[model samples]
Target: MVVARTRTTCVLGALLGGALLVSGCGDDSSDDAFSGQKADDIAAKAVAATDKASSVHMKGTAKVKGASTVGLDIRVDDQGNCTGTISGDGARAQLLRSKGGDVLIKGDRAFWTNSARAGGGDAKQGEQLAGKLAGKWVTAPADGPDAAFCDKKRFLASMDQDKTERQGMKRGTETEVDGEDALTLEKEQEGNRISMHVATEGEPYILKAATAGSEDSTMTFDDYGEKVKVQPPSQDEIVDPADTQA
Candidate 1:
């Protein structure tokens, strides 16, 4: 499933990382609420509030520069527990990571077949591997590529460090996201226009973010502070990688 894992990583990275690219400043004045605030300050508040959240549910679609579009729905907690589904290029998989660091994944036939083929297996071999692996939860190391999907702490750390400085950020009209009051912050980098909606009611968390242009991506964040519920697969339902290798 290396191909699947890599696609997931790339999509998640772009979805999460590209959303926080607000910087510089704008002088445009909107009569709407939040007109008194600077775009950079508002963006900073959203970042800080999101960073303090103990857990969150993220759902989004991202298309990296040269990759196919990927869709993900995941809930993750600071304690490292996560449960999610990822889909791309006609393949899909369900993933779970426990607080104790064990990772498990169950992929559909297309996911396994694509993985096998990506790993250099012939068409027949790919079909055979897919038959054995499809619909079965398989163990992956805590530090493996799949783990990247489950690593909330790591994701946050990367976010903290990816603060890029760019220009042309502006504040837009106030709006509601999922019924919560929000203010929009927008900026254009290179040829892509990025827009973000920061909650105005409570913690100022980013409620939605989107980029349009060279690489299209959109992500929404919600269920802040909710606990991540991750249940490990029963022994009978798990397919050990060692056995598969053997």
Candidate 2:
């Protein structure tokens, strides 16, 4: 059996470290598209469209000072299944879902290193650990400890969030996300400034969203209803913490 995973630097632990990576991105290839409408109005339509589709391919990054900075690249299904990697600090973890609707997370040795750091382990231990479990998989059931934060339904719903109720939300900038034209809905509410981008051409799907100032966070949404297949880690390579912990 493997040495016990320190609750301090667990792969599942990072779930506690950051926010959602917004879903969906990209626009229709057609030339004629929605324009000249309010940012919130366009965003509302995009959210409605996404809600109607119910899934997307999402990617983004978020950083909070003195905390882990996470980068997420994942594909989410309408039913709330995510298959992707959340990488940051000294670790990388992959979240996968089975067709039977089970979601599981697996992390690399670096994940343990980071978990150790979070748990207060020193750097040398992490280095020694790297050689011990590199490329090995430490698995966690999504419903298990520290895994509730990765609920797929909650992650999907976050993309449709529109802050039209904010006191002073308005159009901010016209930018290009990977060459696709985008419109940003800008706002400042109670000292927090937010900018959300939507495609100006196709379906108005969210292109990205960001908050300015300290504790920076950004999420970009696109690829509604694309085919996503997530397979589980092989049993031979899987190690459950519960087994050894017991």
**What TM-score, over all chains together, does every model reach?**
0.82, 0.69
**Candidate 1 lDDT, 109-138, residue by residue in tens:** 877877776666788876887788889998
Per-residue lDDT of candidate 2, residues 109-191 (tens digit): 77766665666668886666555555655555555544433444554444334333422446656788767887666666446
Off by over 4 Å in 1: 1-36, 159-161, 165-167
Identify the leading candidate in terms of TM-score.
1
Question: Clashes per prediction?
Answer: 0, 11
Model 2 ranges off by over 4 Å: 1-11, 20-37, 116-134, 144-151, 158-167, 189-193
Q: What are the lDDT figures for the candidates, one per model?
A: 0.69, 0.58
For residue 54, what is the lDDT in candidate 2?
56
Clashing pairs in 1: none
Model 1, residue 39: what's the lDDT? 76
